[model samples]
Every structure is written in C-alpha cells, then in structure tokens.
Target: MNYPEFLSYDIALAACAALAVLITLLLLKAFALRHLQRLADSGRLHILRYAEQVVSSTRLPFFTGVALLAGVSQIKLSPMQDRWINYAWVVILVSQIALWGSRIISVAIGNAVARQRTADPATATHLLLAGLAGRILLWSTAALVMLDNLGFNITTLMASLGIGGIAVALAVQNILGDVFSSVSIALDKPFVIGDFIIVDNYMGTVEHVGLKTTRLRSLSGEQIVFSNAELLKCRIRNYRRMQERRVVFEFGIAYETPQQEVERLPQTLMEIVSADYLQTRFDRAHFKGYGESGLMFEVVYHVLDADYNVYMDIQQEINLALLTVLRERNVSFAYPRRMVHVTHLAEPQESAGQAGKLAA
Candidate 1:
C-alpha cells in the first residue's frame, strides 16, 4: 500500500520503536515465567508462591501496558491521540493490578484454609468468599480510578450506587442474611460436614453447607435442609464433638428378692462392665431405693467414644448380660401385684330361734 510521503518516515519510526518495546517486555515476561516454572518443578513454589502469583498474573498485561506506553511516548501525537493512549494504558494498569490482587487473595486465603483444614473442613467456603471479596474490592477500586482518570465524578457515582445498593439489599435481605450466616458458619465452624448435630429437633450429619441452606442426612435415612440464617439461631448439640457419652440406667427387682442377692446384683453388674472396659468406664452401681412394688437400683457409666451405634451396642450387651446373670441366680425382676382378704360375719337369728322354743 502507498503511504503519504510526508508521514512515511514518522510511521516507520513509531513502528520500529513499538516493536522494540514489545519484544523487550516479552523477553522479560518470558524470563519471569521460566523462573516460576522452575520453582514449581522443584516443589519450592510454596515458599515463593506470592512472588509466583505476582509474576503469573502480571505476565501478559504488564508487558502490554509497558509496550503501549513506550510506543506512544516515542511518537508525537495530537491531544486526542495522547488521551486515547493514556486511557488504554490506564485500563491495562487497572486490569493487571486487579488480576494480581485477586491471585494474592486466593493464595493468602488458601494458605489459611489449608492450616485449618483438619479442624474445619468447611474451610473452602471461607476461602471462596474471601477471594470473592478481594476481587470485588480490587475491581471496584479500579472502576473508580478509571472513571476518575476519565474525568468523571466518582463521588456522585458512588452515592448513586450506594442508594441502589441499599434498595437491592432490602429486596433480598433474607437471602443476604443467609449468605452472611453461611460465611459465619464457614469462619466460626460451629459444625462441619459429617458432624452429627442436633439442631432444635433435627438430628443428622451435615452433608452440605451452601450459601442458602445446610443439608443433613438424618437418622431416618432422609435429607433435611434448613436455611443458613435459621440454623444459626438454633441451639446445636454437636454430638460428634463429645468425647464421651454418660449413660444412666435403672432397674427394679422383686421385693421378695433376698438382700444377699440384692447386694450381689451390683457385683455382677461390675463384673459385666469389667468384661468390656475397652470403651466403657464403670462409674457406680447400687441399690437406690424402694419402688412401689420392688427395689430400685441405679447404675452409671461412660462410653469412651461418641459413636451412637457403638454406645447402643454396648448398652444392649450390658442389658442382655444383666438379664442372664439374674436368671442364672433365680433372681426375678418385679411387676405390680395385689393381695386381697375376705371375711364373713354370721347373721343373727335370735327372734326365730326363741319363737320355735316357746311353741315346743
């Protein structure tokens, strides 16, 4: 194509300068990226992960912005051209900074979550929200800066957005509240996934923690879901967190049972407990008092683990063992009974007997 003779030299010079700047920055970016790859391959990236983030996120736009600024500076241009170049560079700067900031947010939050992964498996929730928050902040600031650089009134725009945001918040207050509660659950970690918890009347293992609701797999083999906000308001009994389970049981023996047998009952119970002390702690066993129809005995013990199935199995074993011991000894458990007495009175026949004697 034919170029205007008067502008040919200037155009060639500008093109050459732009190419030089672009190539130089590209080489620099390539070097940084190679270093990052080396760190990754050596398994040492964990220590320099932040530096990696900066390098990776800035690789493209960082060089582009520098090249464009250099190219524009090397050539003379009208006011309009200068303004356009400035806007383009500012966009690249804002975009690159936002990208790097977002990566930083991700790395920081991920490290924190990794540290807490053992304690709270819902850590991903917190990490996600934190990274989202950081990106929103970065982009929002970039937007404001871009507008200000473009000579717009940021204060008025922010005020308008504030009012609109309030309206939006009102429209979705419940949803927003639940979202915040989910964030709280993520951070505070009252109960995590797979934790058996009792919330109000609902008992289950948490299956999912979501922005709106938490899902549970109930004992009845069905799913139960509750709003995150409502769940936070309830009293939650996290059975999974219990280190041990305290058990109390009472039984009645017949009143006719001998005192010797009554005394031996406790010993039998102790033996039964001692036979299986692997996970149970024997507390006490004694004849408590007299019931309406029998003698009452109370026993206390603790299961060393929080598993409900384990606890129930051990309890059933104890119950069966106690029954067997009593049966073997011919000791009987009590049931309600009653005793009745009958008395007959002789009726008086004194008048009849006297009349008969007179007639005779």
Candidate 2:
C-alpha cells in the first residue's frame, strides 16, 4: 500500500479500537451500577455489594490496558513516538498493577487479621492500628515499585528517603513519638476500646486510635482527641480491669444504746456482710468511735462485680438487710441527746430570810 493509504488505515484502526474500548467501559459501568441498585433494594446481598466494588476497581486498569494495546497496534509512528508509547505503557502498567496489588493485599491482610482476632476479640484501637499499619506498608510498597519501574536506582532512592525521613522525624519529633506510642499501646493492649479509662483529668472510652492522635468519647458524650505521646505521659487508670469493687460505709447508732452493744457492733456487721450474697466478702468492720450525735461504725466489703449499677444495687440490698436484722434484734440506731440539771433552793431560802427579819 502507498504511504498515505497506510497512514489512513492506521488512523482508522486506532479510532475503531478506542471506540470499542469506550463502549465496553460504559457497559461495564452500567452493569455495575445496576448491580448496586439491586443490592440496595434487597438490603441483604452484602456479597453482591462486595462483588460490585471489585468490579468497579478493575475498570480503570482494564481501560488503560485496552487503550495501550490499541495505540500500539494502530500507530505507525516515528521512533520517538514509539519510545514514548512504550514508556507510557510501562509507566501506566506498573503503576496500575502496583495500586491494585496493594489494595488487594491490604484487604486480604485485614480480613485475615480480623478472622484471627475473632477468637481473641480485639478492641477498636487494635483494629485501627492494624489497618493503619497495613495501609502505610501498602502505599510504601507501591511507591517503591513505581520508582523502580521508572528506572530509578532504588538503593540510592531508599538511602535518600531514609535521610529525608530522619530529617522530617526530627522536625516533628513529638508527632513521631505519639505515633510510636500509639503502636505501643496497640501491642501492649493496655486498654481496650470500650474500657473506661482515666488519664489525669480526662475520663473516657477510646473511640479510635489514629496515626497521630487517639480519639476518646467522654462520659459526657463529647469527643476528645489526645496525642498518644501526651496520653502515654499521663497516668492512666483502666476501670475495666477491676476485679472487684470495694465499698466502705459509716453508720451511726444512738448514744443511748449500751456501751457493750456498741462494742459488739463490728462483729455483728461482719456477720451481716458474710451472710449476704451481694457482698463478696467482709473486709473489716470497726466501732470507729463516738460521733457528734451517735456511735459510729465503719463497714467495709467487696462487691463481686465492678459494674457501677450492680455495685449500687448490691450495696442497697446489703443496707436494707442490715437494717432489717437490726430491727429484728431490737437494736435502736443512735441519735444525739443531752441532759440538763439545775439547783432550785433559792426561793425557799429567801422566804426563810424574810420571816427571820420580821421576827427580829
């Protein structure tokens, strides 16, 4: 064929190929959209929804490959154009492959970790740390792959990156420290997501552990974010780990009660605690001493559960039981009282003195 004719043929072939690829992409998009709509309508096809996501993710890479092949087959270009085409093809292919691979690997790792953690339920913080770590590793791998495919010596690039990273770390030392501390928290498993923890004045449940900061949902329903570095520096109290809750209560008895009964009160209180189901064990009961208005006893016991409401209920039951036992034993509770004495011989003495004066 003549040169002009060959050129025209090449152009026509390329255009046709491009058109076909476009048409296919549109059809795929429509199919995916229809699947999504169906899933939404059913509200039970979670698997189908996931399939749609997978299909959608491949659309970009699929179109890129199609376009590259079409261009190579239809273009009879100069050597320069040929090289350009080759370079473009290599760059796009490497980058797209790296991206898709990274995503797939990330998802797979996450799923495996999640499954493994099912037996040993992990907290939200743990899951967050795992996810963030996976993403960082994935993206780092992708970046390295891209650079290597572009003919850059990875050894030199890696060395340069290391040096640059060191400088950046020094610049943001506090942030880096927090980030590392977050990792430590995740590994150490100091507190879980739903655990109620107190750090200095902040008391809350952990909502999320991010790269730089940890989010807490306070009891008051406000969200607070703290740097992991700062959090680690503070003294933390985790209430979730409490094995038992201790309660100490003081009760007053009337001072009119016999001294001997007051002395025996500690033993009686101990018996009451030991006999109660709500009270785990009797720690101690002491006749602490006299109070301003009554005799005082200090009662101490441990609750079996650390739950606040449960503790309260148990305590209430114990108190009521003690009161009932005291009533049945005819023991009156103490209250403040005072007695007064007065001399009254003045009126008689004055009458006698008046009678003596009249006789004189």
Question: Considering every candidate listed, which one attains the maximal lDDT?
Answer: 1
Model 1 C-alpha lDDT per residue in residues 1-360, reported as the tens digit of each score: 455764777767777787798898778767987887788778865757687777766665567667767766777789999898888888887778777877888788778867765676666556656666777788888888888998889889989999999999999999999999988898899988768899988899887777789999998999999999999999999988899999999999999998899988888888887674458999999999999889999999899888889999899989998999899988899889887888975556877787789999
The deviation in Å at residue 260 for candidate 1 is 11
Q: Local distance difference test, per candidate?
A: 0.83, 0.76
* Per-residue lDDT of candidate 2, residues 1-360 (tens digit): 998998888888888887787677778788887878688579877545445544556666567576656656678778887766766776666666655655564565456556644454355456657766776776687678767766789999889989999899899998889888888888887776667889888898876667788788998999989888888888889997899998999988876787777777788778777874554778999988878878888888888888888988877777898789778767777666776798776688899999999999
Estimated TM-score per prediction?
A: 0.63, 0.73
Q: Give me the displacement of residue 157 in model 1, in angstroms.
A: 2.6
Return the lDDT, model 2, position 95. Answer: 61
Model 2: what TM-score? 0.73
lDDT of 2: 0.76
TM-score of model number 1: 0.63
